[model samples]
Target chain A: MKIIVCVKQTLDTNASIEIKDGAIHAPGSARIMNPYDEFAVEEAVRIKENQPDTDITLITLGGENSRDILKTGLAMGADRAVHIIDSDLDDFDGLAIARKLYEVIKDREFDLVLCGRQAVDQDRAQVGPALSVLLDIPAITVVTKIDFSEDYSRVVATRQIEGGAERIESPLPLLATCQKGLNTPRLPSLKGIMAARKKEVVEITDLPNTAGSVENDAKLRILELSLPPQRKSAIMLEGQPLDMAKELAQALREKEKVL
Target chain B: MTDKSSIFVWIECQGEQIKPVSLEALHCGLQLSESSGQKVCAVLFCGSKVPDLSPLSDFAPHSLKVFSHGRWQDHNSQAVSSTFFKMIQEQSPRLILLPASNHGKELGALLSGLAQAPLASDCIEVECLGENDFKVKRPIYSGKAYASLALEGAGLHIITLRPNVFRGESGSATVLPEADINTTEPESLSLIVREVIKEAGKIDVTEARVVVSGGLGMQGPENFGLLEDLASVLGGTVGASRPVVDNGWRDYSNQVGQTGRSVSPDLYIACGISGAVQHIAGMSGSKCIVAINKDPNAAIFSVAQYGIVGDALEIVPLLTAEFKKILNG
Candidate 1:
């Protein structure tokens, strides 16, 4: 089976963020591979582990900083890596991204394409599904579990539903956006890291629009981005914590109107 | 003409009722249709029956179409795909808006594949750019930056709207002309839902207005009670970091961050949390942020408006007590 895992480098979630002059300031913070994408890479590599000849390619559309994320994938044992380098493409929307990616993977033969459900930062959560549409391939989204039959021609995937989960089966050459808890992504081992240095890491640029639709436009614009308002420190009372709690509860139930 | 009529918004139904996020999508859909001067419609599948459409009266949709499943009691991608395929063929709505929920995401992706339409997901905002073109904006880089996009292609444009970004507008309950409540049985039936182990007795962090979360600095599971007390005092829910959840100090459902649930509460208070980027991605959109940590340089304080650099065990109790006095009095 040939598998492709889409990975993205994301901002460190815990960085102390500052909005200065209408720009977000997240300096000196460490960046990491999107945790969700780790699951995608792990799953792809796991399938490769089960089938020794499986060719796993990790692809990312990002800047130099994204290398950290792709390296982690290589360290996790992906066979090859591809980085589409374009500085002007910093803010490509999911539609634009899907278009760019579809161009690269359209002719490639693959049994499965895996992506993290959503990148943590923007959380738009649209690329995998949109890619499926662009590719005209079936997609199993938010898949919590996936199992292939002996022939590796069909897949039975379990996905989260409204209150429960649903199991669906689809043919190969499909897309699946992996959700967390599907499998525990393994950590990069020392041997794997040394081997990753010798593996294939291809760099491509100026990939043309393969979809042939200049339909590249966005419907939403951020008028302004600002930090949320600060909260006032709580004022401590003198009574017993439990009694004060009851009074607080009554106030919430009565004055606040939840009751 | 703007091709304004025959707009369809996929209403994600939860059992017999529609999800609130779906209503938010309708609110967004109405705006898009109005800007482009088009009529709007709400599409659903036949089940128990469509719930109260009262919440969506604002957009004043020109139609409500219930595509039935004949006898199937659940939602299948192929069944929905075939139904939507038929609806699009009939109505030829220029734009189809879907909620970016798990189900909506799955079905929308699958439907777009079947129908061979353009699909966009997790869109935060949308505006009509030109004739049959829409500009969409969404946060990228873990909410650290933003991106703008344009969708221009063939006849049908399928897009998913992020929840919370479009607050549901309470519309006057008005009914509209109905479409076919049709049904179809899919061919793929390889598995069945054996049991649904619901994550019970816990508030959904994503939907909660106020959230108070803890992290490794919380010490241990026993120390979480103080945070819970604070949450109860504020009539809010409790959240935890990945470590806390992994250490069995909290349930995975209560975990908030990149690997967990993404939330946009009105207020998010971090007690003893160091504020990892993974954790912040989930709650950074909160309207208000308060960080209480012993270390003055804890990463959370960088984004926090008010910082209380002290022991959370000591401070959370006092903070809870203070809220009791102010909110109660």
Candidate 2:
């Protein structure tokens, strides 16, 4: 089975972003492989582990910062990586990014494609579904559990809805956005990291639409950025814990109107 | 088919009832209609029987488009989008508004891909710029910052409004026309839903008006009873930070943060959780936040409107008791 796992390097969820002078700022913060994407990569590797003949190719679209995530995918046991180097990708919306990926993977052969349900940074769960539409394939989104038939021609996937879980069956050449509760991702061991350095990492930058010094091809344009109003410090009622609790209740009822 | 001046609101129904988020999105569409003279249209893909749409009468959408097929009886967004895309191509409505629910977001993406439309997801504010242009304000990089996006040009635009925000009230009841869409499920509808396991009666964290969340400071799963008690009295649901969820102390559903569900409750009470930026990103959009922790410098305090320094095990119970007495009266 040939599988494709889409990965994205996202703003570390732990990093603080600031808006200074109408621009986003996150000084000295880290960028990590989107945490949800790890589950996708891990699931791919586990399938490879169970079926040694299975080959996993990790594909990512981003600027230079994204290559690091592809390397991480390699350390997580993907066989090879494809890095579509485009600086303008960060400015592109989900559909545009999916179009870029489609440009690369449209002709490739794969039985399954997996990715995170949504990148936490942007919090838009659009790419996987859009990619499925662009690729003209079936997509079972927010899949919590997955099982493949012995022949690898069919799949049974579980996804969570508002009040229930639904098990769906689909054929091969399917796309799924993996959700949490799937499996715990393994940390990269020392040997795997050393071996990953020798693994293949291909870089491609010749896409005509996304070439250098080009305008953002996104349909939506960002006009301005501002921070949500800052919250003032709470009035610390410094008597007894019981009294403070009473005061808090009074505040909720009278001042906050929450009660 | 809806006209070019129609603002289509995709309404999601489960069996017979409309999701609250979908109704909220309709209210948003109605509000947009008021200013731009755009007609409000509701779209639903349902089973054999449609839900009680009289509730939608209060919102007074101009038209309700119903598309039904046996395949839509189950949860299949691809089939649903496949049908909706045809309408998009025919009508080319001015705008499409959806609730930022998991299903709504995915459907928005698929339709946008099919039509090459611009989509602003999780938007808190969407305004008409006149002449088929729109301006939308949504949080980006999580809730750390907000981006105002301008959807210009003559092409159709889509906005998935965030729930619990965009306060719009229902208007007088009006005659709602039912547009019949006679369409069969495409042969591409290959996925089949075999079973559905319901987790009954528990309010999802995203849908909760109030959220009482715990973190590492709770010590163990045993201490979660304190939070559960507090949540029960507050009429809220329980949420947890990553550390507790990672520790196997809580189910992943209760987890809130990056990688977990993003929520924007009216009130969020953080107990014992140190505010990691990841955790804060999921919940900072909440209207009011109260943080209780032993450490005065816990990061969660920064995003909170109120802060109290004390042992969560003790403070949580006291607050629950206080709320019970105050609210009961």
Candidate 3:
């Protein structure tokens, strides 16, 4: 079985993200793999463990820093990596990103694809489904459980809904967006970490055989980045736990009228 | 059929009731219509049978449309997308607004790609800039920062409103003309839903009006009963932070924050949860937040509307008792 897993890098920011010159700047934050993508890679690796011959290819689009996630995927036991890097690609809308991924993977042979249900940075939840649309393949988003056929020709997956879960049955060459409950992502083993350094990673500067300009075709454009409107200052309750609880309950009913 | 330039709002329903976020999307549609002068069209999705339509009268959309099929007993969507594609081609709506929900966001994004339409998913605010143009706000970087997106020009546009952000309102009683739109055949779709698995009587944290959440401070899974008791007293649901969920102290469904569900409830009480940026990303939109953690410097307090510095193991029960006395008395 062949698999493709899409990963993204995100900023681990706290409450203080500053917007400087129309862009969000988190001064002291560290870059981390999009948490959802961790689940996707974990699932893909689990598949490879069950079927030793399975090949897991990790794909990510970003600047030079994006390679960190790719390296992380390698350490997590993926077989190879594809780095589609462009300085400006980081800010493109979901449709444009989907098109780029389509260009890179269109020729690849794969029976399955996986991605985090949504990227933590943009929180768009678009790429996986949009990529499926571009690839003309079926996509099951927010999938938490998956089972593959012995012949590798079909799959059954469970996905979350508003109030319930749906079990879907689909043929091979399908795309699934991984959700949190899918699996607990494993930390890279010491041996796996060392082996990752030697893994093969193909790098691409620009999308070859360009279909159309991603910028011109972008449906949505970012106007600016700014802090969300702040909530009013909190009222710190006083006294013992019992007194505080009574005051809070009263505040809920009388002050907020929410109860 | 409505005019070609209407703003179509996909009203998502489960069984007989409309999802709350769908109503919020309709509310967003009405607000957009007031500024754009476009009619608001409510499109209904039905299960094996068409649910009653009278409930929609309260929010009275300008026009109504329905698509029904047996396969839609759950969220079977291949047929649904085809039907949506057909409708878009024939009617050519100016804009489509769907709830940024599990099903709705995916469907909206798929349509965006198929149609190559510009889309902004999970937008908290939509302001009409001018004719056929708009500015939308969506939280990015896990709710730490918001991106203002612009959708301009004549091409079709789609926006998915975040759950619980927009307030629902009663629209004019316009006595809408209802129509049955065509549905794509389930046989042609590539997938099938074998069954729907749902925990009986479980309230989705995203859909709940109140949420009582726990984190690492709860110590262990066994202690979550304290949050459950508080949640029950408040008539809310239980939620958990990533640490607790990762530790297997709680199910992923109960997890809130980046990687889990983003919830914006009327009231959110965080217990033993030292707020992480990812957790705040999922819940900063909550109307009222109360944080109870031993450390006053826990990040959760900065976003909370009320803060109580104490051990959650003890504070939670006291709060539950107080709520019980207030509510039960």
lDDT tens string, model 1, B1-329? 12334568888775566677877887888788778767777887646455666655655566777665533346665556656776676666678888877777766665554455656666777888776677776555545555565666546777777666788647666565555455454445433333334444445676566788999888999999998898887777899999998888986667887678767666677888987866766667666677777787777877775566667777778768767776767
- Please give, for residues B232-290, the per-residue lDDT of candidate 2 as tens digits: 89888899998899899998888888767778998899999999877888899998888
DockQ comparison, 1 vs 3, better candidate:
3
Q: Mind giving the per-residue lDDT tens digits that candidate 3 earns over B1-329? A: 56766889988887667877788888888888888888988988776577777666766678888777766666667766767877787788878999988889988988887777888988889988877788999887667778898998766788998887887657666564665654543556788888877777777898789999999999999999999989988879999998888788888888888767888899999998898877988899888899999998888998988999999999999998888889988
Q: Tell how far residue A28 is off in model 2, in angstroms.
A: 2.1
For all predictions, the C-alpha RMSD in Å is 5.1, 2.9, 2.4
- lDDT assessment of candidate 3: 0.84
On residues A1-259, what C-alpha lDDT tens digit does candidate 2 reach at each position?
8999999988777677787877678889888998889989999999999899999999998898889888888998999999999986655377678888888888798999999988877777888887887788988888889999998899999887765678989998899999988888999888889889999988999864431121222368878888877778766555678987898888877888866
Native contacts kept, each candidate = 0.22, 0.69, 0.76
lDDT digits (tens) for residues A76-103 of candidate 1: 9998999988666634345567767888
DockQ of every candidate: 0.22, 0.54, 0.61
lDDT per residue (tens digit) for residues A150-209 in model 3: 887889999988667999999989999999789889999999989999999999996864
TM-score of each: 0.78, 0.94, 0.94
Off by over 4 Å in 3: A13-16, A90-92, A208-218, B172-176, B181-187
**Clash counts for the predictions, in order:** 33, 0, 1
